[model samples]
Target chain A: MKSAKAKAHTNIALIKYWGKKDPKLFLPMNSSLSLTLDAFYTETEVILDGNLEMDQFILNDEIQGEAETTKISNFLNLFRQETGILTPAKVTSQNFVPTAAGLASSASAFAALGAAMNEVSGMKADPTTLSTFVRRGSGSATRSVFGGFVEWQMGTCNEDSHAIQIDDASWDIAMVTVAVNTGKKTISSRQGMQLTVDTSPFYASWVETAATDLVDIKQAIRNQDFQQLGEITESNGMKMHGTMLGARPPFTYMEPTTIDVLAAVRQLRQQGFEAYYTMDAGPNVKVLCHLSDSEKIQMKLKEAFPNNPVIISKVGGGIELLS
Target chain B: MKSAKAKAHTNIALIKYWGKKDPKLFLPMNSSLSLTLDAFYTETEVILDGNLEMDQFILNDEIQGEAETTKISNFLNLFRQETGILTPAKVTSQNFVPTAAGLASSASAFAALGAAMNEVSGMKADPTTLSTFVRRGSGSATRSVFGGFVEWQMGTCNEDSHAIQIDDASWDIAMVTVAVNTGKKTISSRQGMQLTVDTSPFYASWVETAATDLVDIKQAIRNQDFQQLGEITESNGMKMHGTMLGARPPFTYMEPTTIDVLAAVRQLRQQGFEAYYTMDAGPNVKVLCHLSDSEKIQMKLKEAFPNNPVIISKVGGGIELLS
Candidate 1:
């Protein structure tokens, strides 16, 4: 048996990746940018053995259900097709995230899996090849291939729709993750994105504006304009979620406590703390602000939500293959 | 003094009236449909006196400030120019709706004002004429001039962009309004609408889809297809609010309690109830259902929100000029 292990950080989109132009190939309708966070990540190990009858998935030291195993096998098939490896593999994952908080755990999970698979296969693929490969597992996983600030250009084809690092994010930037009380999310990101694309009236507009937002947010990063970056990030995320509200069955990820968290972030801004909020396809709200203010903001959020956990995170590194 | 009093029921747009093509003339970008409710209304008396120094504005039996007076005077000026009446009228209003709840008291207020002014000036105007006249004061008021299910056409110019009754809504339709707890809205509807029109990436799509929704809902009304009507009404209203979430400075009217009410409504749906909810530019949620089920739904909502108020309303009549 030949095995390899890798770890990848979770990335949160500043310019969100929403609908896909091609779902099978994972080609996005618009480009997106994301920031890899230090707080949460996933470690994945892939073992290749001729003795294995079928692919096995182990998650959090426990055997996963058939659904989870099947998804992993399908994702592994993408690598199998590319690397010409026919032997099934045992895949193990340790996800260090608030399990059902709507955080993008799939991002790190797939990124780590892709990296470990590449290592196990003795494949020295470049960033673009790795990004496109992992994207098949999850669209947002495209950005988790790189560290700091990364932008995934929505290329017209599968090969070109790859993520590239934009900035090292050495600035004093931070995010306070408010893991608000959330029930199991009914609408998965894949289902929500497809629904928005197929039925939302605002989908076309979302695609168009997201492209512009990618450019604007990049410039904000270049200028080290915290306020501009924060505003664009918040606005872009809101617009992404906004399209979901216009879907055929019209759904929103916001729960009651989510609104309360947002109001608290706005209150922080009013009190001279430059905190801005961004939400993904779940009820949890993340506040982006200066690293110096993160502890204070976390304290404030704690007061507002005594029972919830507020974690502050800084910039994280790119995927790493363990020796 | 020549005076006429009129009473108008507040109409809540199903295919919501959002944004404007011509703000000055109050020409909506997309046609909308609404259901007038009997529970809330406004009474206005327009007193035309040739000897009065200037227009005197009174609201809810109290004298209004200069800002309110100026707005009323401007609305009156349109009538003055068209009817050749130079008299400065005393406009007194009795508001029977929740103030600042975003229940669209302006719809009834403007409709009644338009009717009273027409009667006082001896103008035997048709519904189209009255709709166009009232629309200058408020856009949704165009539908308030008619009763039951009304459609306001988004005509190319001022004259054509008027409302007409599509159905008497005598098919046992009813609504249960949930007045969720809310703070004073940070952004007014007029300001929010303009922001959405000017900045929301989804604005154009909203206008286009809203037109389609209007057409489909009107046909549903004609066919008495309760399911189709309810779905379209709920989707359209959600789309309208969705645009605001994509605005430059994104905003949401959803409060914490508002989401709870929506959840409660969804729970009712899960329990095999044919109840759907819609919201305006306020934190309140109104559930639409059959008249036979309204009381039951209201009871359920009351149980969910024991401290809040839930009121049931039926189809309302058109604007009436009280002799």
Candidate 2:
């Protein structure tokens, strides 16, 4: 048995990926840019065993049900198809992230799984091949395979719709994650995005504006224009949620506390700090701000929400083979 | 002094008019539909006194400031332009609505003023003509000139963009006004609409979809389809706020309590009552439910926020001369 262990940090999108262009292949409707965070991540180990009748999937030290295990097995089958390696594999995964509340956990889960499977298969594939392969598991996992600022390009087909590292993000940027609610999400991002794509009247505009935002934010990052970068990020995220509100049976990820945190972040700017807020498809809010002000922002958020966790995170590294 | 006293009820838009295609002329970018509520209204007395030096504008009992007086004066000037009345009228207006929140006070205010001026000037203007006249003062006021479900047609020219009564609304539909925040609105609906038009990436789609929803809701009203009517109204209101969220330096009228009320409304539906919530440019929420269930929904909302005012209202009449 050849076993390999790998880990990948989670990434929070600045310009979000909300809908799928091709859900079957996990192709995004638009290009998305993200900042990989140091605090939250996932690690997975793959064991290639020829004796096993089927691939066994264990998450958090417990063997998963058939439905859950089959997802991993299907992903492993894709790996075998790509690498010409046909061996049953046992996969064990653990998340350092919080309770699922739509935190892009599948991103790091699939990225780590794909990396470990690649290692065990002895197919020393390049990072691009690895990212594209894992994208079939989850669209956002494409960006998690790379560190710092990453962009998942909305390619025309399966081959080019992969993520690339844009910047090292080793500068003055940081994020404060206000985990307002960590309950299992009522509407998964996959379901929400499909709903938005199928029914939201504003979705076509979202697809168009998100593409333009990606270009502008890339320029902002190149110039290190923090203000431009933050503004584009915040507005792009709002537009993503905006599309969901126009769906047939409209929905919102913004809970009351999510709005409270957003107001506090705006107040930080009023008090002369550079803090901007963005929300994915959940009640939680993530603030992108200066690394120097993270402690102050965290303290202010703590004052507002004494019970909830307010975490400060800096730029993180990409996926790696664990020692 | 020939004084005419007129009273008009404020209307809550179901298909909201959020932007201006011709802002200067107060031509809305999209047509809107609204339900005229009987509870909150305004009364205005316009005296065509040519002996007065200038138009004296008094709201409630207090004389208004120069800016406020100028706005009333300007609206009156347009009234004079249309009717050949050059009188510098003494205008006294009183609102029965709550504190100066964005509760569409201007709708009733302008409609009452227009009706009073029309009476004093002896223009003998029909309802359509009167609605067109008041639209210059406030766009939504065009709808306030009628009772029940009124549709403010988004005409290309000033002569045609007036409201027409679509449904008498004497049926099963009713509304519960949940006053989340009656304090003065930070961003006036006028300014917010312009901001959305100028910067919100979602505004264009809003324009297109709003037009579609207006048509669909009108049909729903004609058929007395409560479910379809409620769905369109809720989705339309959400789409309106969704545009504001995508605006540059985004803003929202939903406070924490506003969301609380909204959650309660949705919960009522889960408990098998036909209820739906809608919001405008302020933190207040208004729920449209079955007239039979208004009391139950209002009671639940009142329990959730005992300090807040929850008023139940039914279909109201158009502008009328008060004895």
Residue A165, candidate 1: Cα error in Å is 1.2
Q: Classify candidate 1 by CAPRI docking class.
A: high
Candidate 1's residue-wise lDDT over B1-323, tens digit each?
Answer: 89999999998888888888899999988888889999999999999987889999999989999999999999988888888878999999999888767799889999999999988987758878889999999999899998899989889988888999998999989989999844467778888899999999899889888878878988888899988988998899899889988998899999989888888888898998888889998999988899999989989888889989999999999999887
Full-model lDDT, candidate 2: 0.90
lDDT string, candidate 2, A64-181, tens digits: 9999988888888887877788888989999888756757888899999999998999886899878899999988899999999999988999889989999989889999999989
Clash count for candidate 2 is 0
**Across residues A1-323, which tens digit of lDDT does each residue of candidate 1 receive?**
99999999999999998888888998988899999998899999999988999999999999998999999999888878877988889998999976656789889999999999988987769877899999999899999999899999888898899999999898898889998755678888888898999999888888888888888999999999999999998899899888988998899999888999999998999999999999998999988999999999999999989989899999888999885
C-alpha RMSD over true interface residues, each candidate: 0.6, 1.1
- lDDT, model 2, position B193: 90
- Model 1 RMSD vs true structure: 1.8
Model 2, span B227-284: residue lDDT tens: 8998999999998988887888778888988878888889889999889889988999
lDDT of 2 at B7: 98
- What ranges in model 1 sit over 4 Å off? A83-87, B49-51, B181-183
Question: Which candidate leads in TM-score?
Answer: 2
The global C-alpha lDDT for each of the candidates, from Candidate 1 onward, is 0.89, 0.90
TM-score of 1: 0.96
Question: Which stretches of candidate 2 lie above 4 Å from their native place?
Answer: none
